[model samples]
Target: MFLFEKAVTGSRKYWIWIVCLFAVIGAGFLAYLRQLQEGLGITGLSRDVTWGLYISQFTFLVGVAASAVMVVLPYYLHDFKAFAKVTILGEFLAISAVTMCALFIFVDMGQPTRVLNVLLHPTPNSMMFWDMLSLGGYLMLNAVIALTTLHAEQKGIAPPRWLKPIILLSIPWAISIHTVTAFLYAGLPGRSFWLTAIMAPRFLASAFASGPALLILLCMAIGRLTKSSGLREPVQKLAVIVTYAMILNVFFVLMELFTAFYSQIPEHMEHFHYLFAGLDGRTALVPWMWTSAILAVASLALLIPPGTRKNPKVLAAACGMVFLSLWIDKGLGLIVGGFVPSPLGAVTEYAPTLPEAAIALAIWAIGILMITVFYKIALAVRESLA
Candidate 1:
């Protein structure tokens, strides 16, 4: 069936949502133009703290995109029937997210043409080279898997045998994308905040938690709107995945704290202090970090117990807390914590300027647009089949 059948068939509400996204995208494009003309100086970035909102978001979303494996693995490898319906949604989400990741990298480059440098030079020693390969490969894999499976389902036929190897390939491909992303930071010399052996595991843990938490919320919203989520069992199962992953994420963080404090390494300890208790009286991130802590604890309370997590309303709240908490900690705090206390012991802070925020918003709007259209198309096909 043609995508024109359902991708374009949306109610007034859907049309309004798409229009609003375009409005945001248009505004973002204007702000991006300003940044392009003025360069990185327009944003809060400085010589000391070079990376800011863009890199932070890129870091966080990498995990979200990688989380698709949580769904794909269970359904394909373990044959978990509960995840069958939600797997394609996860794939579509990966596609939208990786697209945003690439855009974030694009805008962060003062000269957009710099992307060609990476593409053309092909440095084997650079972590960035591998990161690009991982992300690019994963994006194509998910896109192919999702589109092929959906096409098959619309016609009520099994996906071709050739697709199985590709599906299996995506499971590890998803992991490589985030692992390489973590290495991008960890491999950097003198960045005490990101230098650690467990960085990849930390990234994976948070990705699994935040990604599935988002999927749960998306499935719930879709279910409410169409009255046919085809994801009730899958959503519940995903809550279980979120619970354990969140636990591991928290544990991994605690392990980092021990390594920093126990070893009494001032360089390492300073980053955590800067995040939670600010150094040199610059407390910009202190409040946000604390808020993330509070929300993390509250979410754990809501999710740890079977009784509370099983409640639809309660689960929704818990998932919201999980998503926001990780956003602040991983998306915003991690990047700042790493850059502050620059190599020479100068403590600099970073925040997004108006244009910077707009550009970020625009990227988010683009992702949402992709997801909205993809979901609409998927739902329409499934409904027709029913």
Candidate 2:
């Protein structure tokens, strides 16, 4: 709750990064203001493609936020000592990711003030309402758990026994956040591409892969900065988790392809076609999707083999590939693909304008800044303990 003492103190490079993040956030605010005044029309979103980059980011980050469970489950449930060191990092990452997810949702709303309506006029029947609830709850849950645990660690004492139940509750709460987000899309009747029971599972698999891959990179950087070898074991364990998750994620893609092509359902196959190839000569996203596939496969190549994965440089590259691949697959491809060939069979295309991209990038910068500050506080606490 009172962690700002450490957060306000950082190195020159850290301050520079924070300043850059602030600049980007400021620019994003300006862009958002333009959209706010002119309405969502300035965006690439059209009548058919209602959601764009903001929703896509929201969807992808929900997985990133949920991925925190990978670390939490092993540490708290199984009592894995290796993960005990970095569990705080994972929870803090979730806090930043969920914060971004909330911001994206807020930005996506044409009228930001209308967001309060979800709370004022609760709609239990709407998946969006459920998503809002889950995301909000998950954010609060992770913040409390992370803060309390860190506070206890700083005080050189165990977290209170009463906190254990709350910590345990976060395990399922994490899953629910992403599941509800998937349902927001999958439950839609006209959205054939998203209408699948496997959507949630696929979301989870990709989240597990991308989330831990990011954590691995962060752990490596933090280890170097802090001169702490404690992260080595946790990094290795997280790499294994990322490896299996990446494999499952790729398998899920295959399963989706098989379901679409094997059945030859026009509605289902159209989206895949639009994503991978061109639908009626509109192939804006074709190259991006293929590139994502290539990156994903290459990442697997580097990850599946233990020898390659053990090499830090190779592992870092592989982790980056996995993150980029999923970012494109889930963030760019999935959201945009679903809207192509809208329910009426019209092939309307959507691309983010400069203002839209700026706003999205701003949200990303904000998330990164939050992670930097939170991790700074966390590292300071660890240093004090040392």
Candidate 3:
């Protein structure tokens, strides 16, 4: 009832955007049901492309979720004045992004409805179950932290002393969410590419890079769209964060390459080959891979220049390019590349079916819609306070 009341009476734009979000989610649900009824056959997922768009989104959003820590760390721990105004907004964004991360996993599962089965009958040995637990716990923690802080602010009173520990606890919990998600990939047995020891580090590096970049982009968007000053100094600080993270991300990727080639393990070498060299005659992914590489280079190149970094438009474009590049690399390229030259030493490829693509689009729409509505409400509340 509270959520409903907030939804309808919130704002015309908010309600309209939510309607669009629901429409898309409904379409995705219909598609999901069709897949459920027909089995995984309806989706582009086969043994080969077992981890498709949905999993890709899950990976990407973990980075998005972790990015909130960037804001929280500076604002709360370091006592940065620049982020004071926007730290709560960052937390809310994390909440919504993490929610979508969970939903994406649900939609991707063969039996999404049976997700509760893990809770009903705990599987201590399963990485998946651990993932579920960690994600759920992190989500609750973030929601509690964000809401309580907001409630305190709204009442024009200090947040309860107890909430400090809870908010502090969420910092580790945030990192754990992304780490566990990376474990989901790295723990798999035969996927040599994903099984690397560096996988988790790479995951964190990319998460830090892309996640902060997205937040910076979102902050800039908010400033332009709503005429809000909205943490420009902190955003610049975050850009510095992304610059270092990108360097590390590139370093890790190169490290992955070094290990694969130097070890001369055919099993490991083959996967990297597919990513960079296009296994067999399949060159479709090659261009995308290069695009990611070049863009990463360009992003770091542009961001390091002082004059260019300070310009909002230039900085925004660089962030956007890095974000899109990482999206392609993590979402499409990594998942698809891992499965090539299947575990059995055979070649297979996967292309998404119409239903699968539609479902993917719908999930993304829902995330955007959530962001839009939440921001709208938050802006109104901030305005009232002002």
Query: Largest lDDT belongs to which candidate?
Result: 2
Instruction: State each model's CA lDDT, in order.
Output: 0.93, 0.94, 0.82
Clashes of 2: 0
Across residues 12-91, which tens digit of lDDT does each residue of candidate 1 receive? 99899999999999999999988888788999999999989999999999999999999999999999998989999999
Q: Per-residue CA lDDT of candidate 3, range 109-151, in tens? A: 7777787898899988887898888888887888888777777
TM-score, every prediction: 0.99, 0.99, 0.94
> Which residue ranges in model 1 land beyond 4 Å of their true spot?
none
Please give the clash total of every predicted structure, in order: 0, 0, 0
Which portions of model 2 miss their true places by more than 4 Å? none
User: Lowest lDDT 10-mer window, candidate 2?
Assistant: 223-232
Which lDDT tens digits does candidate 2 get at residues 212-317? 9999999999888777768888998999999999999999999999999999999999999999998999999999999999999999999999999999999999
Candidate 1 to truth, TM: 0.99
